[model samples]
Target: MRFIYRLVFALSLTLGVSAQSFAQGLIRDAEAEIMMERYADPLIQAAGLNPDSVDLYLIGDMEFNAFVTGGQNIFMHTGAIVIADQPIEIKGVLAHEIGHIDGAHLARFGDASRGALATMAMTVGLGLAAALAGEGGAGAAIMASGSQFATLDMLRYTRAQEAAADQAAANYLEATGQSGRGLVATFERFRYQEVMSRQRQMEYFRSHPLSADRIGALRRSVDNSPYVDVTDTPEEVDELRRVQAKIIGFMVPPAQTFNRYPESDTSVPARYARSVAYFKRGDLDHARAELQTLMDEEPENPFFRELEGQMLYESGFIAESIAPYERAVELMPDSPLLRIGLATSLIAAGSTEQLESAKAHLRFALTEEPENSLGWYQLSIAHQALGEQALAELATAERAFSVGNNVEAYQFATRAHESLESGTPAWVRAAELKAVAQPSPDEIREWNRNQRQRQPLAPSRGLR
Candidate 1:
C-alpha cells in the first residue's frame, strides 16, 4: 500500500481551499483496489449498471464515509474500510450506495457536480455534516457560512428516498446471491445514531436519516432471504483481513498497531501490519525481515513484492529496489501502480539504459492512468534528464493539470505549445491542456452550462 494522507478528512473548518487539495488525498494500493472491485463488480452488475462504467476511489480520510457522487463515482474513506468487521458489511455499504446511484439520488443535491467542479461533490457530502463534523470550536464547519446551511438543507433526504434505496439494495443483494443479513446488520449498527443529536451522530446517519423502521424493513428482507445463511468464503475473509490490516498499519500509530496485532499473532495479516508499523517508524531492518518472511511464504503474491520494492526505494536503496519492482510488475502487469513503482525505481537508477526503460514504463503506465499526477511528474523528470525539453514541458503541464493547478498548467502548456511543431500530436495535446487550464471566452462547452456564474471550466474529473 502506498500510504498517503492529505487534507481529505473533514478538511478543517476553514473555507477557500482550492479543488486541488481534494485531488491530493487519494491513495492507491493494488491489493485494496482489487478487493474493492471483486466485491463491487457483482453488485454493480446486479444493480443493472455496467461494472466497468462505475468508478471507485479510496479516500485518505480517517472519518468513516462512503458516498456516491457525480457519474456513478463511489468515494470510500479508509476509515470506512477499517471500520467494517466483516467482508459483507463493506459490500452491504457499497450495495446501499449503488442503490442510491441507481435511483439517481444525487440529482436532489442539486446540479452541482459539473466538470473540474466534480471535486465539489466531495465538498457537498462533507458540507452536509459541517455543523457536526467540525466537532467543536473552529471545527464547527468546513465550508463558508454563506452556502453551508443551504447545502445541509438540500442534502437532507426524505424518509421515503432512504426506504426506497434500502429496498433496492436488498433486491440487488438477493440478485447477486448475497444475504441481506449483512445489510440489515450494518443498518442495525447505525440505528442508535438516529436518537442522537445530528452533531453527535455519524455523517452518514445525518444524510441517510436512519430510523428503527428502516432497520426493521431491512431485517424483514434478510429474514425472508433464501440466501440468509450465506457467509463469506475463506478467501474473501483472508483478503478482507489483509486489506484491513494494511490500512490500519498505515493509518494507526506504531504502538497501536503493535498492540492491535501483537507479535504472538503470526498470521499473514498480523505480520503485514507489523511490517507496515515498522516501516512507518523508519525501522527498515525489521520491516525488511518481516516482508522477506512473507515473500518466502507467498512468492507469487505481487503486493508483497510491491511493498518490498516500496520499502527499499523509499528508504533510498533505489538500485536494490529495481529487481523486486520488476518482479512485481511481472506478477501484475496490468496494475498501473506497480508499473509506476517500477518506473520510479528505474528513473532513480540514473543510468542511460535505465532512464530509457523508465521512460517506456512510464509511457505505458500513464496510458493506463493519465490522472496519476506523480507519474506525470516522474515522466517530466525522465524527459528533462533525457534532454527532451519540449516533452518535459508537456509532462510538467500534464502533472499540473492532474493536480488541478490550472495556473501552472497553463503556463507550462503555453510554453510547450509554442516550442513544439504546431499541429503535431504532442503540440495538439499541449494545446488541449492549455485550453483546459484557461479556455478562451469563445470556447463552447456544456461544462460551463451549470456554473453559478462565468468561470474557468476545470476538467470534470478527480484522481485516485
Candidate 2:
C-alpha cells in the first residue's frame, strides 16, 4: 500500500500508507486498485473493453464524481466511495463510466481540450502531490495557463449521451448478473440536484445533467431485470466498508473522522478510521493500540502488517519496520507496492545483505510497475548506496523518464550508457530512454494526449 510520492513517505492506509496528512488531491492504493479491478474489470469486460488495458484512478477529492474522459480510464472520487452505502453502488458508477468508454463519448464530445488534465500514468502506488493540489500542482493542469480545467468539472455530456450511457449501464449490469438497484438508488438520492442551484448541485449531476426522463428509463430497465434482486456479497460489503473507513481516515480530517466514527462506535470500520485518525493526530500509542486490536482479530490480514510497518518506518524504526513489510509481501506477493515498501525499508537500513535483498525486491517490483517513478527513485537510491554508479545513473534516468523529465532522463541515460557494459540489459534500457528523450514536438503532443489523466495505478488495499 502506497501513494505515488516521495518514497520517504506515501505509504498507503493499511498497505504501507504514507503518513502524509489527508488532503484533497490524487492517490493510488493496491488494495483499492484490486478492489476496483474486481468491481470494474468484470463490467469493463462485459462492455468489450480489455480488462488489463483499462485503467481505474482513485481521486482523493471529496466531490461525488466519476467519469471517463476517453479511452479505458475511469476516475472515481473518494467522496463517491464514502457516499456509497455498499459495493454495488460503486460498481454501478463504474458500469456507468464503462458506458462512456464503450460509447467513445470523448471523441464525440470534442476531447481536443482533454489533454489539459495531466496525470501520473503507469504507476500503482502514488499520491501525485504536484498534480493533485488543485490549481497549483503541475498535474491535471491546462498547459497554456495551468487552469483547473477538470477540477472545476469540465467534462459535461449531452442529455442524450447521458441517457444512452444509462441504458448501456443497465445492459452491462444485466449481463453480469449484477443489480442496477444500487445505481438507481444512488441516482435517486441525488435526483433533486437538477432542481438545486448550480452552486448547490453535486459535481456528478452537473456533469451528467440528469433529468426525470433519464431516471425513469433507467428505473424501468432495472425494475424489469432478472438480477434486480441481486446484491453485494458479504466479502464485497466488508471490503467496501473497509475502503470507506480507510479513505475517510486518510482523506477526511481527523476531527471529521472522529466525528463520523466516534469513540462509541467500536465496529471494525470505526476502529479502522479512528486508528488512522489517531495516527494522523500523532497519537502513536492509541493508533498502535487500535491497529493491534485489529491485528489480533484478523491475524492473517496483511493490511494490518503494512499499516504497522508504515507507521514504524515513518517513525524511524527502520530495522523494526522490515519484519512487517516482509510479512506483508509474503502474504500478498502480487502487490508491487508492498514489495516496493519492503525494498524501501531495506534500502534505508543500508546493510550489505539488506541492500542486496532490496535490489532483488526492486527488480521484481519494477518489472511489474515499470512506470512507478518512486520505485525507480528507490531503485536509484539502492544502487547508489550499493556503489553501483552506472546502474544508479540508469535508474535515475528511468525515474526521470517515468516522471516525464525528458531532458534529465536524456542526460542521465547518456551518462549511464558511457559506463555500462555494452549489450547488457541496463545499456539497452538506457539507450531506449535516450532514444525517446528528445521527441519531436508532434510526438510530444501525441504522447501527452495519450498520457494525461486524473491519477495512477494499483497498490496494497483494505484500509480496515
Candidate 3:
C-alpha cells in the first residue's frame, strides 16, 4: 500500500521535458514488482523482446487501465490486477499491450502526420482516448477533443493497432503454452460498455475499444489456441489470490477489509489483510495479534516477518522492530525493500555501530534501487549521525534530485562539492548534480521579474 511517485527520467529524455512534471504514482512494493515481472516475462520474451529491457510499472490507481510509454515501460494499474478473475486474464492484457509494442505503433503514429485523420473521423472518439486519463473535466475535455487533435486519427490508428496486438497476443500465449481464455473473458466483460457514454465507461473500454469483430476474432483465436483449456498452476493461482487480497486490504477502508475477510477466514492472506487493516486503524494490539498468528503458522515467511517489522516500526517500537527486520532480511536477502527496512530501523537506533550497519545495508539496497528517495534519505541521516557531512550532503542531493526538488538538490550538491576532496568519484557526482540543478538564464530572469512584480508598489499615488 505504501507507494512512491516515480518520475520516469527516460520519458523526459525522450520527450524533451522534466521527469518531475510527470509524477506517475508508481507503487514501490518489491513483492508486487517481482510478481508482475514474473507474469510479464514470458510474454515479453515471446514477443522477441528481452525481459530485462522491459520495465513493468504498477500505477496505484483504482481504475482498470494499462498503458505503455517511453518504448519499454508498461504502466499497469493496481485495479487491473485486483479485478482479474484469473492470472491469465492479466496475462492476456499484457500480451495485447506487448503486441502494440512489437508493432511500433506509437512510433509509427508519431511518424505519419497527415492523411489518417480523415479516415478516423467515422469511428467513435471513445472520448479522450483512454491513455490521457486524469481526474478533472477539463483534462478529459482537452484529451478528448483539443490537446490530442492532431492524433484524432489516434482512434483509427489504435483500433488497427488493437487488432494487430490481439492476434499477436494470441500467438504469444499459444507459443508460451498459456491459455487465452482470460483475455477473452476480460474483453467479454466490457463488450457491452462500448455503447455507454465515455464518462460512464471504464477507462480500459475507452482506451482499448472492444468491437464485435474484435471480440469475435479474439474468440476464434482463443478457441483455436492449443492451451485454450489450460488453467493456471495451483501455486500461481494461490499467489494471484494472495496478491489480490493484499491489494484490496491496502486499498479499501479498514472496516470494509474486515467485512470482506472476517475472522472466520484463517488463511494467511486473510490474516495479512486483517493485520494491514488493523495497522492502518492504529489498533497495534490487534495488528500484533494477527501478525503473531501468521508467524505461528509460517515461522520462516519473510513477508510475514516484514509486516511485523513494519507494524512495530510504525508503532514507535523502533528497537523491537530490528530483530524481525533483520530476520526478514536474512531470509530474503534479494529484497532491497527488506534491507532498506532493516537499515531504517538501524538508523533509528542511532548508535555509531548501528549507523555503520545501516550504511552497509543501504549501500546494498541502493545497488538494487538507486532511485529510491526514502532509501537515500535514510542513508543521509545515517551519514550525518556519523559526522560524514560530505557524504550526507551527497545523499541528500540524490534524494532531492530523485523527487524533483532541484533547488534543494543544488544546495546540497554545492555543500557536498565544498566539503568533498576534488577529483574523486563522489566529488565528480556532486559536480554533475550542481550542473544539472542550475536554473537556465531565462528561468532566472523570469524568477527575478516575478519577485519584483510581487514587491509593494511605492505609495506615490496612495489615497492616504
Best by TM-score: 2
Q: lDDT-based ranking, best first?
A: 2, 1, 3
What pairs collide in candidate 3? 128-144
Which parts of model 3 are misplaced by more than 4 Å?
1-5, 8-24, 110-157, 403-411, 432-464
Candidate 3, residues 33-73, lDDT tens digits: the string is 66777778889889999887776766545668776553565
Error of 1 at 285 (Å): 0.7
Q: What is the C-alpha lDDT profile of model 1 across 220-271, one tens digit per residue?
A: 8777888888899999999999988887777777899999999999999999
List the lowest-lDDT window of 10 residues for candidate 2: 1-10
Judging by TM-score, tell me the better candidate of 1 and 3. Answer: 1
List where candidate 2 sits over 4 angstroms from the true fold: 1-21, 111-146, 149-154, 441-464
Q: How far in Å is the alpha carbon of 413 misplaced in model 3?
A: 2.7
Query: TM-score of predicted model 3?
Result: 0.80
TM-score of 1: 0.81
Mind giving the per-residue lDDT tens digits that candidate 2 earns over 115-219?
A: 433331222112243432233233322221213323325567788889888888999999999999888888988898878987777767767898788888899
The alpha-carbon lDDT assigned to residue 353 of candidate 3 equals 93
Give per-residue lDDT, candidate 1, residue 289: 97
Quote each prediction's TM-score. 0.81, 0.86, 0.80
lDDT of 1 at 374: 65
Q: Sort the predicted structures by TM-score, highest score first.
A: 2, 1, 3
